[model samples]
Target: MEKKLTKDDLKEIENQLSCPSGSKGIEVAVSMNVKNISMTKASIDLLKIANNDVILEIGHGNCGHLEYLLNQAANIHYIGLEISKTMNQEAILNSNSLGTSMNTSFELYDGEKLPFENNSIDKIFTVNTIYFWKNPNVFLQEISRVLKKNGVCILTFAQKKFMQTLPFVNTKFKLYSTEDIILLVNNTPFSITDTIHKKENIKSKAGDDVDREYTITILKQ
Candidate 1:
């Protein structure tokens, strides 16, 4: 199991994402979008994030999308937990530098045991990292502790069905299929809301099969 990343480790991850050509969000989104038609459809639903909800993300990884989402939601309070210091700091600095007035907090915290009071969150989400948990049961339980009743959580990842379609598959990251994720969801405290399978196509990619991802949404029950 991977230990919680330290500040230096966070910075290392940040440096990698800041590379202009490919990024954590861009790469994942591109591959996922083509993996299935439903992948893009599901991500579009992510924009339904309410203006007044308290939103949280477990593995922000220096992502720009969540911050952009926050900007779109002036009445929403957003928080992101990133294990990497550089990624967290870059997110803070770059986001603030953009001069938006959204209220937000970024913490260097353990993704497994979020340090929030019970029933404190309105909405929670993560992407591409839940399977790495050494104890996913405990991890989801912790998330349940902080979420309000009826609050929603969306977990998205690369689809196992799309393995044949990846433009460049990195063996480092783990991947799961929709059925696999549904089992984990069933074991958790949340009730399944929707499972969206989507395929994304990259410009000039050789095969039509490349780049699909699935996003699953569940409501805290």
Candidate 2:
């Protein structure tokens, strides 16, 4: 018999979705692995990475995408900032396994401030990480600070309506419509270059395949 999702299971899913710390056990790991595949591909597709660009990924859980990106580009440097120590360690190990450690690095961040210097990064991207940002403006400012002039930032998240369908996405997850995100970015130094909408099939908490709508917002600083 298949196990049904309980309140505890939902809560664990919520925690993993917000910030995957790898402590919730195998179920969370399985969910995150599925999410990583789709979200990483979506974010990377928007990047259009160049051979020598210095790219950064915020809240990169497991850094699987980083390994892929590093392998795709010959001379590009990739940096990852993650808040979860377990995920950070896992990402490091994954990079080592890919033999891309020289081109990739991972660091633990508080999600409020970035460790990069001003105008240091050529490109940046994140997937499913905006909801957990306590102060969006501060984080946006930090992103603007670290990004070089005319650099690009791609942020990917599920649309509000689709996000609302998830029982686990409660008050803890700050759901946003495309308009809301555009308005928020308008207040910053960045301007929206493009927005891509995609529908993907993913597993629900009940282990059922469901369609989810995600939006990738491309911004230029």
On lDDT, the candidate that comes out on top is 2
Q: Per-residue lDDT tens digits of candidate 2, residues 152-214?
A: 999888899998888788767998889999989989998998998889898776576778898
Model 1: per-residue Cα lDDT over 19-104, one tens digit each: 21234544433433243334323542563777788888776655456445665555888787876665676668756876643677
Q: What is the lDDT of residue 21 in candidate 2?
A: 66
Clashes of each: 21, 0
- State the displacement of the C-alpha of residue 149, model 1, in Å, after optimal TM-score superposition: 1.1
Q: Which stretches of candidate 1 lie over 4 Å from their true place?
A: 1-44, 163-172, 203-209
Which RMSD values do the candidates have, in order?
A: 8.0, 1.6
How much does candidate 2 score in TM-score? 0.94
Residue pairs with clashing backbones, model 2: none
List TM-scores for all candidates, in order: 0.71, 0.94
Model 2: ten consecutive residues of lowest lDDT: 22-31
